[model samples]
Target: MFVQNIRNICVVGAGQMGHQIGMLCALGGYETVIVDVNEDALKKADTLLQSIMEKWVTKGKISEDAKDAAFSRLQFKTDLEDAATNADLVIEAVVEKLDVKRELFAKLDKITPSHAILVSNSSTIVNSLIADVTNRADKVCNMHFFYPPLVMDCVEVVMSDKTSDETAQTTMNVCKQIGRTGVLLRKEISGFIANRILGALQREAVHLYESGIADYKDIDVICRKALNHPIGPFELMDLSGIDVGYFVMQQRYAETGDPQDKPAACIEEKVKAGHLGRKTGKGFYDYAKEGVKN
Candidate 1:
């Protein structure tokens, strides 16, 4: 089915990405449902969305009427089956675990309509691994969004060998509809395009920091000043969450079994200490006294 024909979207897992994605869909005039098993996460998503809307209003980005219209189209649900019952598209944005994603898609396969497309928002885990779990392999692929989905305009529409061409194109169209630049990856890779580049930069950044040549703060400043990067490697990790960086690296390591693919010790240590950045507060730069080092 064409993306224009899709009216209802179900975004499973109301974490940082899922909720903003649903809001984007709603803003694009689609009936969107953000679902999560955890009630607290759902509540958090609701609060976050409200803050986003208010910020947009203050910035004159979205009119109050338009905000209300989008708000009307957005729905929050706890049940996957109920949220996906009549959805034309299902975007899974849970934790970045292959096994966890496989299990969810296995259940979603039975729940979603036959025509509905099932996509994953995995940062590194390719859809091919999770697509096999579902009966609709032809309709499944990866639709990865960057950190802070609401602000990031770029999205990756990735296709595996089993994915149909129509599915990939339709997903790309859906990205445009939601005001995102959809970069199509005809071939499936672990991190697709953006994250692969990001991973390479991060790997070297960690190597530079861990080698004791420079502190993380100096490294961040040098990158921003030299490379013209909007955010430094360490700051981006903090913004995206140290735990998320660790998991993505861990997943890539699991897939490639490469020593360099393993997450840096600093990332692992930060995650273990519950310093998950902005969410829990401290990461590379302390956010205890000042929140969100922007």
Candidate 2:
């Protein structure tokens, strides 16, 4: 149903996930606009995209003409209403907080085109909770993409009870056209698929370390070399930002109210110290002066 009319894409937030997701939409030949009140953050996204696209050219993945064409499709707007004026789809990658998302979506509802599909890139918080805040709940769903959306192929297409079949299908179609491997979740649940499995692994990894069964580094090695993972659990946490995991766990704990449901003490401490994974230069391991592997 959404094959022809979809064109303009609006992304809210220019943070780590937001900018990359907007870039991917541009690569899909859509007229993409990243909306953020923070001009500095948007400028950073511009700089980051230029660097990433240049690397693509250097690797012979995309021609100069293709790179320029994709770059031409990228745009930015500081005002949410201005950006979503005629947007066919709106993907929000803002901070992973329920009230914050509800407030944003409520505002987006007033400004965006009625037909525009609103989706969130929240890792733990489900769209079911946020969709209700908008009158266009039928058009709202979750389109959770992996970290570094530039390289990752997966996109989770989640629908709440209010999400119409057409809306869900349209979201999946959008994913396919953008070169994403879309996984549909028929049932509404916390954490969807990937994060649920990942959370299970991380929980055990933390337990093993806390219980003195093994150090964090040793656990990472076993997951990497033995399990054939590109990066270990600890490394993944660092790359995706330790603070991100902390918030996710906080949401989950609120739902379950279990002590074990809370974020690990170690993860909480790292965030308090401002060692937020690769971005801050340290988390589970130090990355102040070396590559992620080091």
Candidate 3:
């Protein structure tokens, strides 16, 4: 089926990532269902969407009518099967765990229409592992989105060895239709494109910090001023959450067995202490208030 023909899209998760993605789809004129297993999560998505709409209105980015139209295009649900029953594409954005993803796909495969495409927003897990739980392996692939999916234009499109050409084509087409910059991956890799490259830089940054070669603010300045990157590796890690960084590095380590994949002691220690970056107000730098604290 043509990507533009996919009118009904189901986003399976209502967390920060999933909510943003579903809102983007709704704004782009697709019939989007934002589903979560927990009713509270669905409620939270609704609240978040409302806040976003309000912000857009206040900023004069979109009219009240447009906000209403987008909200009307979205449906929030707690039942996965109900949300995906007639969906043309279902994007899973749940917790990043192989077992959880496998089990979700296993059930989703049975519930969704045979022709519906199944995709994941996973950053590390291989498409092969997730597809193993589903019968429609050909239609299963990774459609990874960075944090705050609505704002990020880049999407890593990953297809496993078993992924069919038709599936890849459709996914790429869908991404284009949604106004996203899509990079196709011919085969599975540890962290895909952006994260893999970013991870390498992060490993070195951690080494620099741990070895007292540079402090947090100085390193951040060098990266922003010299590298011209939007944010330094350490700063970005904090915003993305330290636990997420640890998980991605752990997955990379398991896949490639490379030394770079091994996260720094600081990362492991922060995660163990539940100091998961901005989300928790502490990681490499303190977010206790304003200003960066090392």
Best by lDDT: 1
lDDT of 2 by residue, 1-294 (tens): 474678999999999999999999999999999999999999989998899899999999989999999989999889888899899899999988788999999998988888888999999788888988899889999999998999999999998989999989999999998999999987888998999999999999998988999999999999999999999999899999988899899988998898877999888889899988888778888886785421
TM-score of 2: 0.97
| 1 or 3, greater by lDDT | 1
The Cα local distance difference test for each model comes to: 0.91, 0.90, 0.86
Ranking by lDDT: 1, 2, 3
lDDT of 3 by residue, 197-292 (tens): 887788888888899999978999999999998998888988888888787777767777888678788899999999888777888788888743
The better candidate by lDDT, 1 or 2, is 1
Query: Over the stretch 183-218, how does candidate 1's per-residue lDDT look in tens digits?
Result: 988888888888889889999989999999899999
- In candidate 1 the C-alpha lDDT for residue 31 amounts to 97
Every model's TM-score = 0.98, 0.97, 0.93
Ranking by TM-score: 1, 2, 3
lDDT of prediction 3: 0.86
RMSD of each: 1.3, 1.6, 2.5
**Cα misplacement distance, residue 247 of candidate 3 (Å):** 1.1
Return the top candidate by TM-score.
1
On the 0 to 100 scale, the lDDT of residue 247 in model 2 is 88
How many clashes does the backbone of model 3 have?
0
Error of 3 at 180 (Å): 1.3
